[model samples]
Target: MYPLIYGGDARILEEVLEGTHPGLSSLKCRFCQINSLNPNLVKGKIVLCIGHRGGSEAAWSAFLAGAVGTVIVDGLQLPRDFSRIYPCLHLALVQAMVKELPTTSAQQGTGDNRIAEYNIESGTSMACPHATGAAAYIKSFHPTWSPAAIKSALMTTATPMSARRIRKPNLHMVQAISILVQNLRLVTGDHSVCSKAMNGTVWDLNYPSFALSIPYKESIARTFKRSVTNVGLPVSTYKATVIGAPKGLKINVKPNILSFTSIGQKLSFVLKVEGRIVKDMVSASLVWDDGLYK
Candidate 1:
């Protein structure tokens, strides 16, 4: 089942699964009701009563409401392929727009007029499903992966939002690469690295073969991966090391490796820094593929 729950609350999900509450076939109320005004006045018009970042949630809501499509004109486009991102998101906006938008000349007076009825309105909950859906898609592509591996790919591949005001995908495509490595572990069964290993050490990795700078007093962190193909590998193959981390600040890695190839597939990761530092930035780069392994 494609479960879609909020970031928190696992108990409610369990209850629903146990049949205490209605199963997948249940009522769903969505935010961002659509408004039908002059198309000329509001070119891509969909309305949300709540305030959110870039109105992204509301914009997608309208798509599901019954609009042909949605266009989030702020710094919030998918950081990756701008095309597929809209369809998934537009579902909400289309649903909202369909409900609020009146029948057109072509569909006028026909039995199809039920479009505005509650039966016609379409909706989904605002929860982690968005992330889960992405995760599911990854699993579908690479069925043999561990949970950690899948998570790594998604996080690493997540495109970083640009400074521009329009929404976009996450930029760090490293997530997928890391998940593949995690899968390698499942195959070799050489499991030596501890959970702490994913946390990684402080050193210069130089894996991607690029230059990065971490200013003095500034804490910085980066992730690496070993493999993501072949479904029998473990989820902890990629070893993490941190170097030149500034003082007063700490670097952290979540599920250090990318993807694993066992219970599930697809991978992602998160690198975060906390505390204060004197430097403005720190650099991390990949080790170049030279003749001998350095």
Candidate 2:
């Protein structure tokens, strides 16, 4: 949309531009936003916005500019607080449109008639709602649960996923996010995970996901601390196993067998994750199973 507008402007100037190139369209999509788009060019066209910022109001911005529609393209998860921030931006835009002061140089708007009635959203739109809703839903069930506990519960119970396909592109999709907050039980509160001291590696937290920040070209000798609670059978022993460890990596879990005498019993363990520094991405998993749960 913006590209066509730029080409038309260049042609009108009697300029013969050589080759195809993007001129500030990407920047506008990232930083400049609505102010970057001119009403003269985008009035009746669909605007293509590429990135998702924490404070971005891309959808509302396009609608206010009289764009007939908008398309949002993103590569990552949407910022969690986006839904809360959206209504404020929407109201502010309404106020601005109403108080179209002659003194303000900013193009007030095209008009009420040109406002877009529809929008198409992908990546960002599909992800944020689920996260926000999950947190809200969990809080509804356990109002006393701290934010950190809710966060840990969600992370711990999360299903492992990747965009990898079973067949070709769009043929077989990876399983979607399934957060079973109902099955999650918090042992206790530990705000250290949210504090600045636990800024880098969160391996010590009470969650299934493990992470270790190893600097490049440095020796790969790091230990992770983790805790687990028994939510299944009261009297059972679970064995720890590491899968998909890269070659040359040695992972040893201290006291790998966890025995629970009763439900809600919590146990802690240490993982001595040692490996040689490699250029490729390190992908692995630690599974705890008692021939029942994995």
Candidate 3:
């Protein structure tokens, strides 16, 4: 909806609506939001650009948002035309984004990129959100949780990326995110897996696999909300549930029964997740079973 208001070329808008791109709209919205905001707010500010290779809209959004410049990197090899599109001589750096340390930047034609532009870009876009979500959980479960405490929880609970789909990992499909968050439990929080209390999916071990990240290491629990879309068959009905809910932790789904017609349909319902982090990790298998429509 907002995209229409931004008013790009008619041809670009047409391609966007076709839905051939994965995070194009996400990229578009991010760019729009940041661009709409004050440039001063983002100048010298850091932004996380994920999965789009270097050509990702993430970098564009950051640049327009007033970023001193972007640390353009990718999970894979950096692209050739990247420097051509985003010249480095203009800003601090023009390089691949990495989450790793000893952050470095490579320049083009003339080695004019600055040394002050040292920052890691090792896929922090993916890393930052999980941290943010974990902090949210700590705040929810322990209302008294301080910003510092929440930060501690997130950093302490951090885990490494397990594996990728072998096929094109760069593609951002709802199915890929679902499998990543739900199946691998790569992302922590209630939104990780919608449960019955949430009035959503009914737990089914065999159908949808469960993966979870426990909010606490030594002790304590937390709550969180996750977004889920119908990526499987576009049947008329859909539900959600947590496979093995931990102690003190509870899951609930809002607007449980999902009914829709046609393709590309989306429903955003909150998953009320609250509880203690009895362990370092909690896993739940969410099952989207058939209903009347099926």
Candidate 4:
């Protein structure tokens, strides 16, 4: 119902309906009248229902009756909203490939079937495994590193997403894994590479994403300290830059230039945010760019 929560599993319901009679006409029932329905007819077939009363309750009722799944043809229309519940592939070819996957055992019938070609679907479900795989790969090289360290590595290295310069950045795993591997040797060799003293808060843990909340009524200054372990060439320099800062907001990066003397050398910097009264939310980014890397 309502797009079936995007990735609702049809096989789960099919498994529940296994060995039960199929091809029975789907029954329509009120949300509260599901228990009164005849189980024999409801079992092993799709259930069609109206989602106006409650989508979740109706779906649960169908599940209890051993229905394969529920499809809501009509419901209360709601406002448009974006959800990160999962990722979606906008490509038509990918969507078509997914639809061709064998959903029933009958589709896979025959002995000694050696399949040479395959197609796949993409979503948060798909992305999650890739992220986990990246983490596992990093773990292979840094067997002694803790989970938090690996997570920090991934988060800190991910590419930032900017929408119309709105300053909202999402996770980019490819870039994250690249940076993780690039700095793996330095991180593994230095016990102090994952020090908590470097981060001012959980949000500032060299994370790939961050948010800053400033009270509107009072003028306040917030300082965040961050440190980076040099894994590149010895004696490298990086410059700090802030983008899309709001009016009346002053940002200062103490020692804006970071100079590293050797591999495994750690450098610290202070980010001070001073803002006056403001009515609207402000978004910005603090970036440290070496000539070759960001």
Which candidate has the top score in lDDT? 4
CA deviation > 4 Å runs, candidate 1: 1-127, 162-294
By TM-score, the best candidate is 2
Candidate 1 per-residue lDDT over residues 173-252, each given as its tens digit: 57644765557678556664535355544333312222334565544444433333323344334434555555665666
lDDT of 4 at 48: 58
Query: Which 10-residue window in model 1 sums to the lowest lDDT?
Result: 1-10
Better of 1 and 2 by lDDT: 2
Model with the higher lDDT, candidate 1 or 3: 3
Can you write out model 3's per-residue Cα lDDT over 1-294, one digit (the tens) per residue?
111112121113434435654344433433332232234444555443333433333455555545544433445564422222333322223233333223333332133234324333323465566557767877888786545445544543344233341223444546643564454454343355444353443322111123344435444333234444343366567765445556766767676667656444666555555656655445543444555321
At residue 5, give the lDDT of candidate 1: 22
Error of 3 at 74 (Å): 33
Measured on C-alpha atoms, candidate 1 has an lDDT of 0.39
Better of 2 and 4 by lDDT: 4
* Candidate 2 lDDT for residue 241: 90
> Model 4: per-residue lDDT, tens digit, 1-294?
223321122223343434353432222243312443345666665555554443444544555555655555443253111111111112222212333333332113233133324434444454577788899999999886677678877875686544444221334646754565337656456543433345246546554345566666579777777777776678789898998877888989999999888987987877888868475566677777888866
What are the per-residue Cα lDDT tens digits for candidate 2 across 179-212? 2333333424322232233355555555556766
Identify the superior model by lDDT, candidate 1 or candidate 4.
4
Clashing pairs in 4: 87-124
Deviation (Å) of 133 in candidate 3: 31
* Candidate 4 Cα outliers beyond 4 Å, as residue runs: 1-124, 137-149, 162-210, 214-218, 276-281
